[model samples]
Target: MLGGAGVLLGVAAAPAQAAEVSYATECIPPAAAGLDPVQGTTKVEVTAPATAKVGDEVEVVWKFVQAASKNPDLIDLPANSVQPSGTLKAAGAQSGDIAMQGPRENPAIAKGGAMVLSDMKGKLKLTTPGEVTLTPDAYAINVMSTDTKCSPKETVKSAATINVTAGDGGSPPASPDPTEGTSPPPTSGEPSPSESESGSAGGGGGSDTGGSGGGGGQTDFTGKEVAIPYACKTPIGDKNATSPVQINAKKDGGSYDLTVQFKGSVMDSPADIPADSVKPSMEVVLGGADKGKVHVEGPTNSEAIKSGDPMEIPDLTGTYKPGADGKSTLSPGVLTVKALGTTTTCTPTKSAVSLTLDTAAQEGGAAGGSAGGAGVSGSGAGGSGGGLADTGADDGGMLKALGLVAGTAVLLGGAVFTFMPRRHASRKAP
Candidate 1:
């Protein structure tokens, strides 16, 4: 009788499974129409210790660069025109952007005209034991001068990952008592209270797969929210300390369906941020994709995220390829919302964002035919620099070269004319 009931439940739930995929697809918006992103690209590089203990504070240095000569020009305004800021906060650590205005020193212009924004630094306090992906929020820069009539916007985003291990004997310090042995923390290896509850719910249905069963393969972010602070000048000269963003993942066959929602105050980022003036978007470069592809999708205001409603980032649904080690690393991309009303673009609070995926269960069962399982690789660094120095030939030098060429041509013509006349006269005399 119990087995028969289980079968009936499965049959009823089949429609829900199809709905999950449809929902995921509709959430993430397609690329903008007629607006091709700048031909230039940016990269992010990091410098930090390989491993650190929980509760320890560490400094993470970031170097942003414009990869090639085709790199787009950064928004150049007076120092106070637009505020450039970001944060180092991630899953385990707590930190903030070091320089509020911009990088302390002007970035260097390297050979091949690569723009390098180096020495931008920040600190993070490790609170949990696990690998944390550090992706600063989308730092908007002015791509045009202050005089432009209508200034379209561009963004700067990069990522890095840091591993935080347990302090004593590779275990998190749970209690202050010295006698108590080290155990992993809440976000660590051991199951959390929520995960345990989720697992119990799944066990009853006989659908509990390997690992913590949050919908069998889903990553549950039930009560938690990712906070990203932002500050800007021009349109609204204020800073938002807390902007709550949520990410929910559900297993969809071999892939995962993700739903990202924005909650809390509608005026968090900008109190009166005009919905039409603001272009909200997100770009993700995950390693688990087909061929190490960077997927850019957003402008969610149309479908998933509306101006007044709590916007949801949809279509983050895809199968993650596991690496050779049976695990896939994830680097978080920037969530950008640009305001075209003014020339300035603000920055997000958390820049370095990342997550991990355990694909061993799926690989062992269905994807075992592949040789090397796919995994998420770390993202590269971007660079920025001041405008190229004036190095071309001056007007005086150009005139001088022109004059010399003209004089040489005249002299040669005169010599030919003189010699030809002499030869003709000699022939007549003979």
Candidate 2:
């Protein structure tokens, strides 16, 4: 698995810090109590308004508590991490740094066994009117073996929702009666007078589409850009092998072009197994305007697993806008593979990679110059922002042990039942 400290190194060096940083948090609801995969009762709760306006700045607070068994051992809280997921977005604080605290002590042990509690606050504002639902699905905590650090078992806890109302200027005013000496209104489908005026403003000096009828065209958020750090914890079939991460992003049209490449190989013991049987896969989870899972399969086709040849997944092309906090985060998702008719799940070593926006650079561009690279496509191999790629995780040996036991059972059964059948021959007591 990727370590949190290791992942931060991949991020670009920050410029001199400014006095104040405008921050915003993604909208999300809390999680209900449930069982953590490792060993404990996991409870998550997020408190926020049930409804908000389009431009209303809302505060979202969350708390996570994990109660595990009380062993005399002291565990690092960094290893037990949790992250917010779903439609919520974050802008200011470093997402990788946002997590539960407490160095090596179990705060909830006295109340129960071993308990960890984390409380954090974030802000958000909805851009569009809709039913926004945010859930806490990222839970990376694993049960370690006496001799080895096994892969983390990830699971989702609970979720919450918010209904964002339309903006103040969303609807048009009612038409006055022609009988009152006023001119007749335009057709029902046509843009109103106010909308027509705003459309002209958007087209004259901005890139806003004329058809956008409300709020005098969207404010250009293109100049916002940041180098987000990332790490690869699990590489396909190998839990111990290194998994490198590379991200190349450019502003294109209204969105950002992101191409994430994971480089690693599958290296499990008993190498004589058929290469075609090894199918390893990993995914990247991105937040912002574009939020979802981008799944990448290991080495296209059913190619054999070779140490020299690393797995290069496909590119992710989409638009990305700043979230409420004005920042974005790229994180490691789940990793899975199938070998010898058994599937094994693995988690990344690190929790997340954070990207903070360069406000000075953004202001310079916003002054007059337009952000470059509209509709630009990802140039494979070498391109701008292509230089970022590096790596390194572990998994339980449960599947392998089970498979071995099954094979041994089959062999023993054949010797006892199939071969010894003649002892109780069909001729009865003979």
- Runs in model 1 deviating more than 4 A are 1-223, 230-241, 267-277, 284-332, 340-356, 360-430
lDDT of 2 at 4: 73
Poorly placed runs, candidate 2 (over 4 Å): 1-242, 250-252, 255-257, 263-276, 287-299, 302-325, 354-430
Report RMSD (Å) for each prediction in the order shown: 35.0, 30.8
TM for every model, in the order presented, reads 0.25, 0.25
Error of 1 at 323 (Å): 5.5
Residue 336 of model 1: what lDDT?
40
Local distance difference test values of all predictions, in order: 0.30, 0.29
Lowest lDDT block of 10, candidate 1: 17-26
lDDT of 1 by residue, 33-61 (tens): 11222222234455555566665556666
Q: Candidate 1 clash total?
A: 33
